[model samples]
Target chain A: MASATELRRTPLTALHEDAGARLVDFAGFAMPVQYEGILEEVGRVRTVGGLFDLCHMGRVRILGERREEAAQFLVHPNISKLKFGAIRYSFFCREDGTTMDDVLVYRDTDEVFFCINAGNRDRDIAWMREVVARYDCELQDLSDDLAMIALQGRASVDALAPLCTGEPPEPVRREGATGPAALKYYSFMRGSVCGHEAMISRTGYTGEDGYELYFAADKAPEIWNALLETGKSAGLTPIGLAARDTLRLEAGMALYGHELDDTTNPVEAGLLPKMVKHTHDFSGRAALEAAIAAGPQRRLVGFTTAGKRVPRQGYTLHLPGDDGGAAIGTVCSGSPSPTLDTIIGTGYVRSELAEAGRTLAMDIRGKRQDVTLVEMPFFKRDY
Target chain B: MSNPTDLKYTASHEWARLEGDIATLGITAHAAESLSDLVYIDLPAVGDSITAGEAFGEIESVKAVSDLKSPVTGEVTQVNSGLEDNLSVINSEPFGGGWMIKVKVSGDLPADLLDAAAYDELAAADAH
Candidate 1:
C-alpha cells in the first residue's frame, strides 16, 4: 500500500478539503470517502440531489474512420448498432470470457468514447492500443485532460438544465428539444456548461435521474462550485465515495473488482443476456458462447439479511442448517441500505440455490446469520 | 472534546470507569467519531470472561468493522443490549449511555492504562 504522500490527488482535491471531506486512499488516488457522513450523503442522493467528482475515472477516445470497427471488435457490444449520441454498457473481456473491465461506450459523430474504471485504466488502455493496432484507429488517453462530474437524484434536471446554454443539433437531439431536458436516457449532447465546452450525458451509476458532464480539468472547481451554489435550495450536497458504494450496491450495479473480475464471466454475472450482442464476432465471443452453452455454475444473487449484521465481502455463505459446513458461495459486496433500512448484499452462489425466496446462512465471525435471496435491483425510482 | 478526567483509557481507545472491583467499559468520543455512523455493535453476554488488551466485542460502521478491546481482565456482569438496535447513542453520547458492559474484575487493572491527560496526548498524536 502506498503512503498518503505517495497517493495522487485529483483536480478537485482542494475543493473536497475545503468542504471538510474525509479523504482516503482509493485506487492510488486521494479521494473523498465522505463529507458529512455516509448515511446522510446516501439520503441526499435518494431524496433531492447530490454532486460527485468523477475525475479519477478514466476516459479514452478512439478516433479515425475505423473507430467504430475497432471498438466493435474490442468490446462485447456491437458498436456499429449504437446510434449517434447514444451510450451502451459493454465489457472488455479476456480470451476465456472473463471480464477485464466493464465500460460504457459512447458513440459520437467523429469519435467513440470509452468510460472505464480508474484502477483498470492503464491495463485497459494498453489492451486497446494492442487490439486497435490492426485497424487505422488511434487511442487517446483523455483522463488527465478532462474532468467528469455527475449530478444525480430527483432535482438533477432542474439543477443542471438552467446552467446549460444553446441547443443540441439534429441526430444528437432527442424529442427535437434543446439542453438537458431534450436528452433521453443513455444519450449525450455537446454543449457549454457554465461557459465551458462539455459533453453532458444522461447517464449515472446511481439508480436515479442524473447527468454526467465531461469537460476541461482546469475548470473543475468553477463548475463544481457553480452547480452547488445553483442547487443549494434544492438540498444538493457534495457526496463522496463511501455513499457512492452503498448507493450503487442498493441499485444492484456490478462493481468491477467485486462482482466482475478476471475469474468471473459475464454469463455468471448476468450481463450476457442483455448487454452482449452475439451476432458480431468480438474478442472472447467463442469462449463466451461455450460458457453460455455449458451454463453458469455459480451465479450472482442479491440477498437481504435477517439481522443488522452486514454480510461483508469475502464472507462465506453456507446452507440454511449448515453453519460450519463447506462453503456454498462467497459475498461480493454488502451494506446496510439507508433507503430500505435493512442489510443487503450481493454474492455468487450455486446456480441450483440462487432462486428468490430461498433461505441461506452467512457465517459472520463464526456465527450464522440468515439471508434470503431476492430479485434485484433492491430500489428503483418511480420516474 | 476533552477526555473525561475521571476515567482511565486504553491505547486501543476503550475507556473504563473503575469503581472498586467493578468497571464500566465503552469507547471514547474520539473513537466513536472516527468510526462514524455506527450501525451495529456485538457485545459479550453476561458471565463471559474477557482479557485485557483482547477484543471483547465488535462495532461496525457503514463501511468498516472494528474490534472493541477490554481495558480490564474480568467477567461481564452486565451487558447493554439496547445498543444493538440503537447504536446512534454510541456516536452522540459515547461516554454516557454508550457504556457497553460492566465487568467484575478478576485481577489487577492493566498498569499500562493511561490517565485523561495522557490519553488526550495519544489521541491528539493519532489525529495527524
Candidate 2:
C-alpha cells in the first residue's frame, strides 16, 4: 500500500474533501470510498442516480492509418466490424490465453480509444507500445490530460441530456431525436458539456442507463459541480468507490484483480464465446480455441448464502460433506447487496459443480456455510 | 459524541461499566463510527471466559472486519442475542443499547484503562 503522501490526487479531490467523504488509497490514488454510507449510496443509485469520479482510470488513444489493424491484433473483439462511435467491452490477452487487462474499446472517426484499468495503466501502455511498434499506429496516453465521470441510473438520461449543448456526433444521431436521447447504449458522441468540449458515451459499470463524460482535466471541478446542481431535482448525488463496488457486484460485472488476473484466462472468467471474435487471427486465438475445445476446467459462478455474512475474496469453497477435506473453488468478489437485500458472491468452482442448483460450502472464518449457486446478475433493471 | 466519564475505556476502543462484581461491556462510539454501517456481529456465549486485551467477539462492516477486544478478565454472564439481527444499534447507540455482554469479573481490572478525557485525546489523534 502507498503512504498517504505518496498517493495521487484527482482534480476533484477538493470537492470530495469538502463533502466529508471518507477517502482511501485505491490503485495508488487518493479516492473517496464513501460520502454518507455504502448502503444508502447504493440505494440512491438504484432509485435515482449517482455520479462517479473515474479520472484515475487509464485512457489511451491509438492513432494513425493502421489503428484498426493494431486494435484488431491486440484485443479479443474484431475491431473491423465495430461501427463508428460504438464502444465494445473487450480484453487484452497474452499468447497463453491468460488475460492482461479488460478494456473498453471505443471506435471513433479517426482513432480508437481504449479505457484500461487504473492499476494496469503503465503496464498496458508499455504493452500497447510494444505491440503497435511494427504497425503504423502510435500510442498516446491521455490519462492525465482527460477527466472522466459517470452518471448512472434509470434517471441518467434525464439528468445528462440538458447539459449536452452542441449537436450529437454525426454517426450515432437519429433523425427525429437530439442530444443524449438520440444516442444508444454502447454509442458515443463528441459534443459540448457546459461550454466545454466533451465526449459523451452511453455506457457504465453499474448496469444502468447512463453516460460517461470525458473532458479536459482542468474543467473537472466545473463540470462535476454543474452536473450535481443541474441534476439535483432528479436526486443525483456523488457516489464513492464503495457503493460502486457493491453495485457492480450486484450487476455481476467482473472486476480486475478479483475476477481477472495475469494467470486467469478469459474462458474460465466466462467471457469467451460472446466477448471474443474468432473470425480473424488475434493474440491468444489458438490457445483460446484449444481451451474451448477442451472445455474450461473451472467456471465462474454466482452464489447466495442463507445468512448475512459476506463471502469475501479468497475464501475457500468445498463440497457439502467435504468441508475440511479438500477445496474445490475460491471466491472472487462478494458483498451485501443492498438492491436485493441479501449476501451475494461470485467464485470459481470446478466445471461440474458450476450449475445453478448446486450447493457449495464456503469456509467462512473457520466455519462451513452453505452457499447456493444462482444465476448471475443478482439484480437486473426492468428496462 | 462524548465518551461517558463514569465508564472506563481501553486503547482498543472497548468500554466497561462496573457495578459490584459485574461489568457491562460495549464498544465506544468512536469505534462504531470508524467501522461504519456494521452488518454483523459475533459475540461470545454466556458462561464463556474472556481475558483482558484479548478478542472475545468479532464485528463486521461492509468493507472491513475487526475484533472486539475485552477490557477485563471475566466470565460472560449474558450475551446480547438481539444484536445479530439488529446490528445498526451499534452505530446508533454504541454506549447504550449496543452493550455486548455482562461479565462477572474474576480478577482485578487492567491497570492501563484510560478515563474519558484521555480516551477523547487518543480518539482525536486517531481521527487525524
RMSD of each: 2.0, 2.0
User: Which residue runs of candidate 2 sit more than 4 Å off their true CA positions?
Assistant: A1-5, A167-171, A174-176, A274-280, B111-122
Chain A accuracy as TM-score for every candidate: 0.97, 0.97
Candidate models: Cα lDDT each? 0.90, 0.89
Poorest lDDT segment (10 consecutive residues) of candidate 1 chain A: A272-281
> Stretches of candidate 1 above 4 Å error?
A1-3, A274-279, B111-128
Tell me the DockQ of each model, to 2 decimals.
0.57, 0.59
Comparing to the true complex, what docking class would candidate 2 get? medium
Give model 1's share of reference contacts. 0.50
- For candidate 2, lDDT tens digit of each residue in B1-128? 99999999999999999999999999999999878878889999999999999999998899877789999999999998999999999999999999999999987889999999999999877761
lDDT (10s digit) by residue, model 1, range B20-124 = 999999999999888888878889999999999999999988788889999999999999999888899988889999999999998888899999999999887
